[model samples]
Target: MARNLSTNTGSQAVGGRRHTVGRLVHYLLASPWRVIVMVLAGMTAVAMIVIGPKVMGEATNVLFEGLLGSMLVKMGAKPGTSKQAVVTYLQSRGQDKFARMIDSMNVQVGVGIDWGRFGTILMFVIGIYLISILVRLVQNFLMTRLVSDAVYTMRRQIEDKLDRLPLQYFDRTPRGEVMSRTTNDIDNISGTLQQILGELLFSVFSIIGAFIMMLTISPLLTLIAFIIIPVMALCAGVILKKTQPQFTRQWIRTGQVNSHVEEMFSGHMVVRAFGHQGKAEEEFEERNQELYQASFKASFFSALVTPMSTFFGNLSFVIVVIIGGVHVLNGSMSLGGLQAFTQYTRQASQPIGQLASMGTMLQSSLASCRRVFDFLDEAEEVPDIEHPDHLGQETGGKVEGHVRFDHVRFSYDPAEPLIKDLSIEAKPGQTIAIVGPTGAGKTTLVNLLMRFYEIQGGRITIDGVDTSRVTRHDLRSHFGMVLQDTWLFDGTVRDNLLYGLDEGQTIPEQTMIDGAKATHVDEFIRKLPQGYDTVLNEDSSELSQGERQLMTICRAFLSDPDILILDEATSSVDTRTELLVQQAMNTLRKGRTSFVIAHRLSTIRDADLILVVNHGSVVEQGTHDQLLERGGAYASLYNSQFTKGEED
Candidate 1:
């Protein structure tokens, strides 16, 4: 069932389209002007190439008429279309008559060539060159901007989605794979889009114009060009059919490499302690080699395309020349006309090669699209419901500090229930301690209360209001949490503390200092040279473990939550720090309902109610003294801890 759900999620994210070149093109075309400019520029350039040669041919014919025939006719001699007539007239004409003809013809036919036609063709060629360059420049600029914007927007969306994704999703998807999608995969897609659109789009336009020009110049040559199309198509199809799967495999290998590297970095302490440097290197090399092989195969097939297309292009050129030569010798074609036809053939072949090369780009982009959409489509763990009733005035003035869980059952995986049929109630201004063996779902209970994970079986009510009906943001914001690990962003202590405060609430220096004192954190803050304004380093190594915990606790106090949960808040601190923290916890718990999870046993001795949980069930419940007197699980637990403490 989980597998089925994941599959459905993947489909939904990517819109369930098969990853293919065509689809990749669709994504690129998402920025319409980039594609439009490239296509139009290319089309116009080709049109210029085709028409330029024809215009030049016309200019050549005009030159021959003016120089050889028209001049002779003006000099008192007959101008004939036939070669024999011209020869006869030349042989019979006297020197004076020839001079007169030259004089008269010079006036009638000044300069044989059509200068206007020649000039116009030259200008069109120049104009086409300028337009092509301009279009290319614009296309490149826009495509760069577009691809950058697309990747930036995409990464931002994925980051936002990651922030919202359920904690369980992180357990299944590796950090490295997610990182690769944002960085490496995005880079690859960007490169492909730019290269394909910039170079290949232009090549395609040139080929189209060349083909049409060839057809108009000589139908026989155009027919010869058609023969090579099938060959180019077959080659592209065969290469693509083999490379598409290889490209997908390549991306998977990339993910594997990334995952391994990230794991090595995050678990360096464990790896070093175990002395597994050699083992880690060996594993990394294996993954790296797999990536290399897949990448090589994908690239090798892509590389074959241009050469194959060129071979067909050259072969077609050979055929066009041979057929055209025969027509020329048979007096059916001109020298200039044949020259233009050959140029057109070369031009026509280029687009086919470009279109063929586009195959590899398609495969790569399709894979990236699939990955990107997969992230976008993943189920949001907690959704901010539309028009959710605000918990504002409904809480009836500052929450009343009452919370109830009615037969709440939840499972990370349905097959294995983590918290089953659990029910509890906490009165206003009460401190409730939850004690259990590790994995007794202690943290899971807190998770449910915070609405981080929804309960599958029963409803949790806060101030007699069902939590499901309220906005998760408002629900969580009303509570404060200080966990075993303190999360300190790269900022000043004051900034981190201020993060918890509500908008428009000015944090006074005395108020900030008092909140820190309540958590017993002010001592450390005072010792720092910059006090509250001291900036945390990237590693946050400047502060001790206990100091960090105190800072987080102070954050909670400053927020003044109606309810609080401290999950092993003192677990990492030393004995001296624990005493300080315990004092802070006691002071902060006043007039507020609190849920405390502690391993030390001593921290929660004063809890108004002690609930002993074992194997996801509440086995014992009462005040600390009452549970100890009953001599059940709580009594046994306290005794064990006391014995261990005495031995220490």
Candidate 2:
């Protein structure tokens, strides 16, 4: 089980690939108020757009009404007004009177215009502008707040889900890709929401309102505007259809880049040791260029939207002018009306152009969202039952470290069993050693002891209680582990030693130093400038392998757990350090149940009982002398290593 969990699985996920804008919107709409605010702000902005032209048209009508009406009256010989003087007055006062009238009307009317029509328009303009800005501000705050909360909540959920998911899930996915989903992909969705609130939503509404206003002002001109919309939509459809795959491919390539970089970085020493620096660099460059090409393709197609939409918009503008000119010649539309129609044509086409531009971003965001949700949807290994029994402190005290495996059968995959029908028991405070060649079930035995993998057809018990009844944390926390690879996080040596140690209870420094001395780590610590305060970089790079192993043994000593599993604990140390670590293990194993799995038979010579495991079953069990007398598998293993050691 341990062997399988440590190995990577290269299986890819299947199904649930296609994602839609509707689905993405559903995630944002998780918080309803935020989406509602965004829609209202958009609608208000659109309303202002439609209303602005109407207000201007009303002011235009007022100017002409005073000029031309007065001109007709003077031509008909009205007493006070003359044509020449009136035309001159119309140039200044007529337009001025209309502007003032519009201003006065704005003060009188509120949201609706007509009573003091101009005043109403002004008030409406002010109201809509303020409301639009306020709504926009609130909408941004809310949308961002929602996305922030969603990202946080979703990331946490995925992490928690990963904790419960079966080990098989990790076998199929790279750790780096999973991390990208939680961090990078979530940020993509967040960026989309920000952009939608800032620009896309309002632009869409403005384009809609502009179309409607053009329709009302001159249906003939409106028809010309409508003709361009289909061409624009068609072009957008074509570009987006082609670009969507490129965007998806780009994100996929990015995941590969992240995975490759992480794998190389984590295994840099091995890469250099194997003389694969050039090969590694070549691999990275290939992946990077793939990403570059994908990005270029996506960007190029997305960029096409702007120019295509602009060309259609300009073509529509020309049609609008030619049609509008014919209307004016027919005496059906005024010069002011034609000017307003041109404004509407430009305003209407702007949003279409904007929406067309966003098609690429939308596809990219959707691709990212799919990857993120896929991680969230991964099946957990062992789900917590809703009504799970709570384990109490009394059970903690009752654990006597008497571990037994009853007819245990296990496998990484269901069809292949790694450990089959294996029965073993270690009485309280007994030392049991498991020995086998590499790829045999030696480590798997300890893995079962730690409950890292569950048995398929048998029960494992600690004392009298089945391991299934307790939480994984509760079960694992009671055991102390020392693996061959001693991983040290970046921190002061003392800080790393104190990690997972009791918080409120103080640990005297003398005890820590004594533990270090027992493991022979004190020799190295004392030579350093800061002693136990010396800081170690990632993986304890400054320390020799022996020194790092010693520090881990010292940590295990401080922990004082009731049960200990040592998997190749002395593999990294030199002869002298091995002897010192052996001494420490001797002291540490006293009055505790210990399971030791090792390739070096010398380390387990003193083990009270030895079990030789091969091909997932115990083939022989006895002490060293007994196994030698029996001349079985254990006898041969001991003879081989013992001969090599003496020859060296």
The candidate scoring highest on lDDT is 1
In candidate 1, where is summed lDDT lowest over 10 consecutive residues?
101-110
Give the whole-model CA lDDT for all candidates, comma-separated.
Answer: 0.77, 0.76
> Mind sharing the TM-score for model 2?
0.84
Task: For candidate 2, write residues 19-125 as lDDT tens digits.
Answer: 44555666667878777876786687668666776666666555544454444454453434433444444446555443333332212111222336556656766
TM-scores for every candidate against the unseen true structure: 0.85, 0.84
lDDT of 1 by residue, 131-161 (tens): 7567667666766766676666767877899
